[model samples]
Target: MAATAVPVQSRGDLVLADPASPVATVPAAPQILVPATLSTTLDSRPLDLSPLAGPLAKIAQIEAWLGTELIEREEATRVALTALLSGQHAAFIGPPGTAKSLLILLLAQAFDLSKFITLCSPHSKLEDLMGPLRLSQLPHDIYERLTNAYMPASQLVFLDEVFNLSGSLAQTTHRLMNEREFDNGNRVERAPLISVFGASNQIPQTPDSAAFLDRFSFRLWLGYVSRTNFPRLMALYANRPSSAVLRVLAHNMPIFASQHGLLTLAPPPVTLGQDELFSLMWAAAHIPIPQSILSTLDKLYDDLAGKGIYVSDRRWRQSQDALRVNALLDGRGIVTNDDIAVYTNMFWTTREQRVTIAQVVERLGNPLAVAAVDKRDQAKTAYDAAIAAQADTDLDSGRKMNATVEALGKLKETAQSLEALLAQAQQQAMNPTKIQRALDAVQGWRKELSEYVL
Candidate 1:
């Protein structure tokens, strides 16, 4: 079969079309900086990444907005934005009302891209998702969407209740997610999709949907807010006006009114060139993976396999991209032990196994750092236990005093040891961010130890 020729607009420009209209051109640049390219070619060609100098800054702005807009979702927001920068799909698994769908929409607004969203179900048809195919206007034998206002043409797509999609729709979606292309009743066409954001209340239990689930490179498990943040969350949403308040409310208003509101209430001033993003992605794929992490992953695979949990070799390779992308987000040109935090999302097959996987990754990523954290946590637990024992009538006051003293001594020793380790790490750590984290932890431990009573 001959490769279908898509007319070139600009060398790296993303040409926007109405899908219903005969030709598509780039949209007019609005108030905020314009976004460049969404999808790269299937051949894995390096995308032009010249414009990426500003993306990290832009991403930081979006992350700040997400942190304030959604309570307790700072990490999830970063993961999702990283997926966008890497030009990969992300899925959010959580109960409804956790702002899963809202995050995707907010990103679309920030990028000023066309947004397409659908609530998927078992009964959904291909036409419902991709739009109905119609006879082509051109003489060639082909079929295409009658309208471009569907998932295939949109820059950002959100498929809520994605796991609920069943039958042929699920299979079609799997192809869409993997290849970013689908047969349009006549010929295969490239999807103009940039990033797909899927949300579900649970992971797929059935074999069919599970395959589709694996296409998402970044999968985040979200849950309810903590009790400590519940009241503050309520107050923020109820009494506080967010940065997104004006734009979100104007969504349903007239186009002129909405555009004006958007122009005035631009989310972030930074822009990411399509070429620059693609170049970064190419760079990330080649970023060095430490041999230690590779060995650790191999052992982790064996350990998990022994427990009847299995990960495909393909998933393992794709996970490398996640690590590289994480490194890029951390402002590193190279992958380091610190980036192994990516495994916290990759190594777990079950939600219950997440904590264990996190611990394993933390130990492998930075053994000394993890050890310090563990010692501090243990000291805290011992101190808390001693205080509770002191309140008990059965425990003698002298015994309680001795226990408290022992716990305090352990805390002091651990704090001092961690401080020494932190000082040593600062000289050798490649990533300054990781070193600073160790420094902060050591300082926190010292402060905690200073609060102890004789």
Candidate 2:
């Protein structure tokens, strides 16, 4: 058969040699290719990089208002302020007239206008805090105006006598403060609020509710001004009207807020160690801690435990962070022993425990000094009397004299044991590390007691 050239089909069908035969395999479809080297064009515009300015000069003015004599409660105030700036709620508990409301007002002034809201006692309500639904005359129907009427725009909210609100209202406010959102009848609106400062004359004897208490992230105890600061405060009050001072404070608000932020960013200069942790734990365990104090510690411990309450380890890692914040305000980079003492003293606990621990710490070095001296004197007096009696010779027989001496020795041993226990308790406060050493010494002494005839 003569070879015939097969013609390729153009735009029309072509006859094939065999209709049933499989058509030649179609060539593989061509893949659409993308360029590998497409360059990203740069605008080449310079960034408006500007150095951050330090806190406003007004901050210095506020500090000057605070004056050179500082209150013992100032440390607690700083910690509360920092927590507030971090968008955490705090409760300030103390007797009335400790400037708790004034502090909140100052905090409000520190923020820009419209960023701080102050709701004074016995009058604040849920609607006052979260805005109320207004009926517009034009629309002839109710419309929700998320008004910033009483609410501060992008700022903190201070509620004085927070416990005064009705239970339902307080619960609603608590939820909003915690979740940052509120139900406005038809829809939920999230507010720009950051911190909520709640102050009361006294800690609610019975807390409002667990839900309410949980809303606060920090708790602080505000106390009367130190004796050192009292005279200065009195002089300031005597010389200037509170209203005029408030205006000055208002003018310096921005600066104060900026300074506060700067202080917060500064690294915690102090690191709490094992000894500090032990001291804190000892104080916490012994002291009758207020609800507010417990709440604060619980939050701190929760943060440290990574939100788990059942961790096998009890570490004071969170306390280290708190210590650092404390040190930064104190203007130091390294935490000192003094810092630990100061912080341990600040945590709120029962008065009895506070006094006891303070006494223990104060007498750490002299735990046995007074008692040992008295003991020695008594022992000497007894021994001298015993010798004197032996000189008398005929009153009692040798066996009776020996028995009396042995009883005196037992009395001495009892006194010594008591001295050792007192020393151990004192050492536990001053330096927990020395506790084991003291314990070992006590055990050795106890073992020796077994050898005594008594």
Candidate 3:
């Protein structure tokens, strides 16, 4: 079925209209103005600027933009964006000053969506997250919360330090995050939320918020840049002004112009409509899961359970949605080994578990990498055999020299081809650590090539 168009009711507003229902218009919500100065030099990496044809292309654009803007966070950004496309929430676990809040805010503005953002605290009131209640006409006894322009109406929401939400506020937000519906004074109102991006310095400790924490599909742990990249990070920050400095001199169009003009002007067109996105998500959800992956998941479930990090059955099922999105975006009809890497983030409880999950997933999820290792080993054996054959005194000198040259040439060619393969893989790597490991291996091989200079 063709997707229905859910037009914005007001400027930058996205209304949560049922896909089966006719177009519904709601009052416009207030927009949050983000300064154009917030944008930095997107990485110089080649970008696919081809015209976007659908929601998938829009997501690709966002992914490319994220790669350019952030350093060493490609995997986390991709997962978070996938969660958003899948109509699921994501959480970033990191200390302060890690660009978690900034990235989410930038994404909301990039899509021109209305947003409700706040720093969560135990003292946060319902009126702050939602809205205050008001009496109705001719019935002082009847009242309703004024949800206009609140979290209930916004398209994107960000809660910094989300673990601090407690008591009744936490209970309300828990329901809101889970169902996308909030309780007003007298009725339940559906929120127009595409995704809620949450950030916290620590994991939720209180029992009350743990269930709320489980709602996030992608949980990423970020930290300071590594020593190797720290110099590049400093150069980027010191040489140029951070993108967040708004410097627009638009004295004319006050209605349409602000520090945000730099961001709004001639931005990339949004190709995916809400209906199409939802439909794609529906399709992804139904994609077939192979028994092998199911078995791998079963083992993973038992492994994590042993470590006291239990993933609920529901989470295990919903996790398929992310893998499905990954396959769909990659233009594959079925999920493959590459998609299993998502479990690293989907099932982990702490940063240490992230390491364990990654190692396990690499072993079980990537057939190509495993094959490459085997092939490299086989090539090594063949090279050694050729060298041994050349060393045989029973052979003629002319033939021996020829054989030695031939063996050396073959080994060099093998190393060169493997180096080229590593280069290609590095281009698509979401995780920098894997790419670095490949690079190290290539360097070691290059050094060994010189030692074979017989």
State each model's C-alpha RMSD to the native: 10.0, 23.3, 12.3
Most lDDT-accurate candidate: 1
* Model 1 / residue 411 / CA error / Å: 3.0
The models' CA-based lDDT, in order, is: 0.66, 0.45, 0.64
Q: Which regions of candidate 2 fall more than 4 Å away from where they truly are?
A: 1-53, 56-73, 116-124, 137-145, 152-154, 207-211, 226-228, 241-454
lDDT of 3 by residue, 290-382 (tens): 666678877777776766677778888788878877766664545666788888888776678788877777767764454455546655665
> TM-score for every candidate vs. truth?
0.74, 0.45, 0.68
Candidate 1 segments whose C-alpha is farther than 4 A from its true place: 1-52, 135-143, 228-235, 242-266, 269-276, 290-296, 390-406, 430-454
Model 3: residues with Cα > 4 Å off, grouped in runs: 1-53, 135-139, 242-276, 306-308, 367-437, 444-454
Counting clashing residue pairs in each candidate, in order, gives: 5, 2, 7
Model 1 scores a C-alpha lDDT of 0.66
TM-score ranking of the models: 1, 3, 2
lDDT of 2 at 385: 56
| Candidate achieving higher TM-score, 1 or 3 | 1
